[model samples]
Target chain A: MDVSNLGLIDFHAAYAIQERLVAQVASGEAPETLLLLEHPPVYTIGSGGSEANVLDPAISVVRTNRGGDVTWHGPGQLVGYPVIDLGRRGRDLHRYLRFLEELSIRVAGEFGVAARRVPGKTGIWTDRGKLASIGVGVRRWVAMHGFALNVAPDLEPFARINPCGMAGCPVTSLAREADAEPTVAEVAARVECLFPHLLNELLPCETETEGGRHVCCRLQVARGKAPLDVR
Target chain B: MATEITMPKLSDTMTEGRLISWKKGVGEQVNRGDIIAEVETDKANMELEAFTSGVLLETRVTPGELVPVGTVIGIVGAAGEAVAAAPVAVVPEPAVTETAAAAETAPAPAPEEPPPVHLSVAGEEAVKASPAVRRLARELGIDLQTVQGTGPDGRVLQEDLERLGGAGVTVAEPAAQPAVAETAPVAGTEPAAPRTELHDALPLSRMRSAIAQNVSTSWRTTPHFSVTVEIVMDAAAEVVRELREGGTPVSYNDLIVKACAMALFRFPQLNNSFAGDGIRMNADVNIGVAVGLPEGLLIPVVRECQRLSLREIAAESRRLAERARTGSISQQEISGGTFTISNLGMYGVDEFASIILPPQAAILAVGAVADRPVVRDGSVVAAKTMRATLSADHRIVDGLYVAQFLGEVKRLLENPVLMLV
Candidate 1:
């Protein structure tokens, strides 16, 4: 995976760059690349999001072609836009979402914040609140608009609207939960460092057995650290 | 053979998605890679593309209708294939579709839905009281039907019984009393109070109890400390004037909210909750503006202040304040506040600290902005000023951090234009 650290950038500018990279990766012209950066304070609603969930009418919201409700992006939050060709890996949006969630869980763990997925909810959460949000857009099986992890940004912006369309949703950051205050840049570096291992372990699971019967796959990371297998 | 098109799972959590619109109409020629329809998942909308070149034969779903993943939304086949051609092989099991439709269309289970009307055995209106309240009424020798309930839907409360004490109701002294304690009240036990006179014993309203419960919880659980700052609001006043003249009608309080949001963005620690062993940092900057109603206090949150401009904040604050004063504020409107700003400036107060709302780390109490003499560069000069006090959780943040956060707010307010970015 190729990694580029683009510090704080505008949402549209980064999105344009992502579309270009997505096209390149889709056509096999470029390697899978990760653009790690933060956005200047803005609220973005995906194609699946409703404007009704945005309670405050004064704030300008950008609607994008991504799956999910309204979400806020701004400084101090690490946004990882991975341009990867899922066509070659597996054209499985479900598996891709899980891959992103697992990657975020591992990254939060690196910062000493234990994060995991809640049943029926898409994102990484802790006892305190939601830590990372994953909303991906796939064009030609190339995924973009990946995930946003709260690092040390002001959470007050999330209050203006229901985060991810769930009212009274509590959004937390690594700096709030971890003993060590990790900057957005530091968290982005951690993601860049840890994503490859997580991708390898989570992406290649077979959804079917030798008998051709469909079986659910589970990642047993709790039993031991070294042994990883599909079950 | 007709190729079946099923709804795709665009996001991991999407079990169902709404069929937005059909880009290719039924019976239209569709080529491979052509956009077929638009589907809206819970989080986003995606364009479903045709995988096989064929004529659109039939559409099983309509626009704006939600269908489950793996349900055949449409079908494509040879141009001669009629729409009436049976596609039974591709149709989902009747039971599956029925259950999915039921789940999608059914209203959320309302626990508060009034109970089914029971046929009265004796044709008498049923008294609305809990079994426990009925049991207590039996012990207190009070007739429940005669008692005016203060609870929701006119249900009787325990406090209502205590208020009946001065009303000549006889108290049963025996521990083992018969269930027939529905005895008549003794005459001349106590003289009835004058109905026309002012009554001193006022029952606590539900709002009052709620306020008491919240403040008590915060007082007990949170270890709080306060920091006070005197802001020179000269530039902020000018900005307010310019905006009002420009028809924006922003107040000094709105300027304070924007400034505080910017400051909170820089000082994330102040926007965190002390969760015993660790601090829980909030994601959005929701600042609650305290609205003083005649009944009690209502802190309607001004959400996402970090993303809102001064004019926007002013409009939102004004709307919320209006709703609060009119008693039309909703539970959603007043909930989910990360920090609070309580201004008593209109009341002509100089400065006063406030209690931190629970689960939130801080609250800013603002005094009236008035003309005051201040020392600047060695000489006393008259400047418009305001004093703000921030009460914060000491467990989550120290005095130094609170002081610095307040200092940032002071800086933004003093400069005024610095908060625009």
Candidate 2:
């Protein structure tokens, strides 16, 4: 699997870029691309989520076509967008979410964050607070939008919306947990390292890339784009 | 005398709305302000008011179709009025003036061959359940057709699903062989005959599924820690007894709800929900009173509980509880609750923890109010007391906040007169 990592930026710019990429993927133009970015303090509602959960209407609330309820996103948060053909990678949304959650938990563990999955939720949480949020939109079995891990985000904006329909869970950041702020880029690199192991475990065909240092998998193809090769 | 019924704009941002369903069909006599149709706006679903008191002449928009605001959805007129002669026109393009003149002057073209009536077999004979139940079922991954509905017309009810047995059946059925083996008696020398079951296995009802999903989700996702507080309800019981003797029967649950509501005013954070990122302090103090019905528990909210007096809370709660029990509550009553209170006092429960309702940070579980010996002013006295527990999602509420919130509830309940003022 070919894994691509992007940088953090404002929510609208990131959303626009993701939207453009989605359109291309939907139009059968661009290869399946996983664009990672961050938002600058915003709340987004999922397909069937209620606006009532959004307590502060003055803040930006972007209505998204994702599965799950409303959640918050902001700067210092590592948001990963996996634009993969679910058909090519075994159309299992639950499996995909589990993998992302596992990866986040692993990443949080690297920093001694002690992150784990809440018994019935789809996100990763630390003993103190929620470390990451997950919401995805799958179009024609192709997945887009992904998890947002609080790296060093100012959690004040989370108060504006009911994150993932859980009204009162306080958002936490890796920086807050570590008691020292680490740039999202540094966290993202650490997270990217776990991707290879996750890809090999999740996908069937695995291969070594970059002088056998990293493992990768070439997913089966259907019609639109090249199979995702994650390393 | 055709009275055109256009879709009224429910919200400021609503340019177009989808007609969910028409409660009253064509030719149905409707009074003014009756909910003839349900419209889904951008923000929420709202009822379409029937401003005209007359017979519904015709329906212009089908359910589930989106139409612009002010679109002529239907027309009303006196019985026997020829409303069919009225010109049909879209809201933006009003062709009625010219079309009406043309119709009056020119003989109507022989009605084009009557179109074939296409009836949906899928819709006909399909199960009839409330939308909330269906939504709950879909979330819980339960098949509605399986549940044996006990509601009117065999409608699978939310309460029915909320029942402990109902949820146990759905949750345990997947591993039924193991469950049965564990619970059943050991086989004798002669293999025990399979338990005779008269009923067929049914799918989980939507409400049951939702309850399962929510309860399991809350338990699994949040690191829930509960703190119990014992309130000396001697004052509260006296107030209730006095009220009842004065011809105003009020429940202890009503007093608890009022006390909690008042406590929330002091600790607004308790009125919040866990929005994964942070706490969202709700603006309204709508209190969801958890009512135990045959199926399960339903928390019908008593909106603005802080504003209403104890008497008002009792009256409104009684009404809502009755409506919920009868399954006649309007959609409005079931939604928009900011906080919830669950009472198992009547069930003789000393104390029990409750799952936090999503979006709300905490839920107050009221145990039975009973007579207990307590030390008051250096003397042991038998006093009426009730045990209550507050379950808080650690992510949103800290230990101190929970303690403070519970303390306030204790103060208000101990001094019932303060709540009245």
Candidate 3:
């Protein structure tokens, strides 16, 4: 996994860059790339999401191809764009999802946010409010458009939309919880460090790539090395 | 006669469903129960079955399209029967055009001359554009609506908004404007801060909102009281061991479900639902086993549990659980339950209470069965015991009734062989 740290940018511009990058990887034009970005404050609706949940029409709403309903993104938020080749790592979306949740929980603890996964919900949430949101899109076994962690950005924008299609659950920021403002760059670095360990733990040891420098790795089952033999 | 295939409510909270795929295209013959399309609800992906056997005349919406609860997605009618001319298209045009004309004339006055002045504010005074283009430009925060379009009559379709970098337009008021924060003046000479709009506003997802409503209503409407009982599972555990030794594997939940079912036979009123006018005792003991799904909890009923054997109950529970996890359980599988059970035993929870499912007067919550030291015959002894709580709606059943009901359950669970009989 190649990590590129991008500072805060406009939501539309970030999405445009993501589309180009995903297309490039799909055409084998670029090696798997993960572009980390923070947005200027916007609400997005996924493929099956409804615009009706957006209470404020003034805010820009971008409909994207992902698996969840409506979610908010804005300044003071840390958004990770993971463009890794899952084919190189076993194509287990479930395990990948679990890794994402674990990474969020770990990063949240550093800021004393006390985040945990809601039993059936896919994101990390606190008792009073949600701290982070996760929605992903995969193409050709490569993942893109990952989780968003609320840092210091004004969460007032979240009130305008039913965040993640869930109502009554207020969105919270780390700054609000920690009572200290933290830059997006600071949070992204912590997240990048936390994700690789989780990825390695879930993937088989043989699947680890060369030198473990590049996170993308694939393993072919050896005859005797099979964990279990049916015969 | 033409039969309109409206969007069916796939779940209790689903008011609309997205057509994932049209399995049967237009002009194809379809029989009753034939899956014409796959509808993705908030909770799961469900197959839309044809309720009437006929030729699929027309598909109103394509795959990836969504329609409201009463919106017709397809038309089914006899062969050679002329389907009703897509009624939706005919209905919306006249009304929509009328409203569009009214909106154009009404809102044009207040912001009529402000566009030119607004264009100058953003440093783009030379641009000239139509009202529609101006509206799009304003929405994209673009002031370049003055750029001339090459389309017939210079009409803007969505691309023009994208081409302008979505900048330089001061036209219509922003739709769904965020609440503007009032900024205090830093100094007497300094201008007040620009009205900063905060937060992304969105509509509530029907499913999530419904869940909230149901939970709150359950707490408010039901005067619920819970009773916890510890069942010494030495006999039940031995019974399970013997059964496993005989090549029959069963879970503790299987025994609990069976025990609850057998106990319901003794106190039939406990196996009843609160009808609007009066209490309705169920003829059969159909127990709903709650299974947690990826999106939420779904309880699939094991119908006629009183007639099924332990092995049969185990098989049914396993089948229902697999179906719930795979998102393939039918509507009937979730409907028609007289009682429900939720288990947190695997999580090592020693005791917990559950909310009563609507219409069903009570629910049983099972916790971990563990070995604990207890005073047996006035001496301390390590005994295997499981804690179970029964939450009942007090409006429908009294404390004495619930006590008696719990007693019957305790007897059946303590005497494990009684369940088999």
lDDT per model vs. reference: 0.73, 0.67, 0.67
Judging by lDDT against the true structure, name the best candidate. Answer: 1
lDDT (Cα) of model 2: 0.67
- Interface DockQ of candidate 2: 0.02
Per-model DockQ against the true two-chain complex: 0.15, 0.02, 0.01
lDDT score, candidate 2, position A178: 80
Q: Highest TM-score among the candidates is held by which one?
A: 1
Between candidates 1 and 3, the one scoring higher on TM-score is 1
TM-score: model 1 vs. ground truth: 0.45
Q: Is candidate 1 or candidate 2 better by TM-score?
A: 1
Candidate 3 residue-wise lDDT at A57: 80
**DockQ: which candidate is best?**
1
Q: What fraction of the true interface does each of the listed models get right, in terms of native contacts kept? A: 0.29, 0.00, 0.00
Off by over 4 Å in 3: A203-231, B1-421
- Model 3 per-residue lDDT tens digits across residues A144-173: 677888888887777888787765557887
TM-score of only chain B in every candidate structure: 0.54, 0.55, 0.56
The sequence of per-residue lDDT tens digits that candidate 2 reaches over residues B1-421 is: 4555556443223345666668798789988657677654432334445545788867776775666555557766676555433232232222233233333433323121111112233642376566545434432223456566798888777655443111112321232322345555676887776752312224344366457657876788878889999999989989999989999989899899899989999888878767544455566699998888778768888988878999999999999999999997755576668788988899899999999987678888989999989998999999989999999888877898899899999999999999777
Off by over 4 Å in 1: A205-231, B8-21, B25-29, B38-47, B55-58, B77-81, B85-421
